[model samples]
Target chain A: MRIAVVVFPGSNCDHDAYHAFKHVLGVETVFVWHKEADLRGADAVVLPGGFSYGDYLRAGAIASRSPVMDEVSRFAGKGGPVIGICNGFQILCEAGLLPGALMRNRGLRFICRDVFLRCETSGTAFTSRLSNGDVIRLHVAHGEGNYFATPETIVRLEAEQRIVFRYCDPTGRLDPEWNFNGSLEAIAGVLNEGRNVLGMMPHPERMAEAILGGTDGIAVLGSLLDYLESLPLKGGKRGEVAREAAGAAQKGAEGTKGASGREAGGRCKAV
Target chain B: MEETMKAKVTVSPRRGVRDPQGRAVLGSLHALGFPEVVDVRVGRFIELIIEPKGEGGPDEVEARRRQEQRLDEMCRRLLANTLIEDYRFETEP
Candidate 1:
């Protein structure tokens, strides 16, 4: 299937995403300029990482209002699979396509390193390849990756099981030290309520190849193909796939309701 | 007669949210022996001039009302991320 990588003016990771999708994953990929109105017949869309618009007003504020976002929003409304990485995640939050906001890091430092992420819930278009509670390593680099949301929104997100990934240690421990950006509950990635859109701080494309340090990210990237293959060969009308996925996620959350009595539980109640 | 209206907007992090930069500044102040400064917060200040849309401006009351509304919209839509930031504006007569 063909994938479209949206390129903003200051987007630095566009090429990395292109290389991973085209060279590594062997998927037909094309670059769609920020000003382009149409998505150029892409089955999936990726908003790659970068300081779009120089991150002037805010990390993703200016880039969110660019001309092409209008199309992206429409594409998302149709329940299309869209992945926003790093600054792209910030842009999605700014554009109102996702819940919560990526505030400045709690330590106020630009953190750039490899971090471990636990697959919080499975069946998502982005993480369908992995089983629940799997740990994967990916590189995260950002100054404003601290994810924050209102207490009510957090509750809703948890109840819906939209939290796709959480920071963790190699042994899958959810301690504060593993949280690279101090995101609430160590949230590294999240899915929109519709379950089709995903926004995350870590760069999966960066880790898609073994030469680049790790190939663990391919599970996240390759899930797109797996998801598309599972859907009926209709013209991108896979709303049922998303619904079934969300149903599984909700069940997973219900199954683990009383099991996780850790810091995340305390923080949730404290809110 | 035409008049140019000016506005000053101040944007700051929402209370109860962690402000690392502000905390760093507070630490520096404490190190400098300024114990009197119990709290420190960082914010942004922006100023802009706005002209009425049509050839001539509306009456003073209507002009101020329109300007205020536009400024609020600007802050909500672009200038500030209301989720994590609070914004206030002052319009000059």
Candidate 2:
């Protein structure tokens, strides 16, 4: 299937995503310029990370208004898979495609390093390849990656099980010190209410291969492909796949013998 | 009359949200022996001059009202993200 990588003026990870999808994953990939109105027939959309528009007026605020985002919004509305990594996550939130916001890191430093995450939900398009409570390592680099929302919004996110990932120790313990940016509730990523849009601080494209020091991220991308392939031949209607996936995830959570292991927290070295 | 309306906007992190930059500044102040400082919230200041669209037809009062409305819209749309920050503006008479 073809994937479209949306490129804003200052996007630095566009090529990394391109390489991962085109060469590593063997998926047809194309770059859609910020000025382009159409997505050029992409089945899925990835907004790669960078200080788009110099992070002017706040990170991702300006790029969120780019001409191409109009098309991205249209694509997302139809229940298409959209993954926004790092600054792209900021854009998604600013554009109202996702909830909450990414604020300055609590430590006031630009963090660039590896962190572990536990899969909180498997129903979303980006997490179908993972089991609930599976832990993986990914790299995050940003100055404004702290996630914040109203207490009520956080509660709603929890209740809906839209939290796709959360920061954790390598052994899968949910401790405050492992939260790289101090995101609220240790949230490392979240799915939109519709479950099609994913916004996360970590860069999966950066860790798609074993040579890059890890292959954990491929689980996320592979999950999207698997979800797309599993849909009815017609692709069904909006929310069809999401609904089925949620049911499957719920079943998986209930039937797995390892459910208690998840609660105990340690599975293995995350990466 | 394509008069230019001037405005000043201030944007800051909402209360109770962590302001790391402001906290860093606060730390520096404390190190400089300013224990009196108990809190800090870093923010942004922006100045905008809006020119009316092409020989506007509105009267002076109406034009000013429209300008104020546009300024508010600007703040809501771009100048501030109401989710994590708050914004206020002052316009020239």
lDDT of 1 by residue, A129-165 (tens): 7877899999999999999999898987887678889
**Native contacts recovered, each model:** 1.00, 1.00
Query: Which sections of candidate 1 miss by over 4 Å?
Result: A235-271, B55-58
When summed lDDT is taken over every stretch of 10 residues in candidate 2 chain A, the lowest stretch is A261-270
Interface RMSD of each candidate, angstroms, one decimal: 0.7, 0.7
* lDDT of each residue in B1-93, candidate 1, tens digit only: 256778899999999877888999999999999989987889889898877666335476776677688899999999999998999999775
Q: What would the per-residue lDDT of candidate 2 be over residues A203-248, giving only the tens digit for each residue?
A: 9999999999898999998877776666544364423443344334
Question: Looking at candidate 1, what is the lDDT of residue A168?
Answer: 96
Summed over model 1, clashes come to 0
Proportion of native contacts present in model 1: 1.00
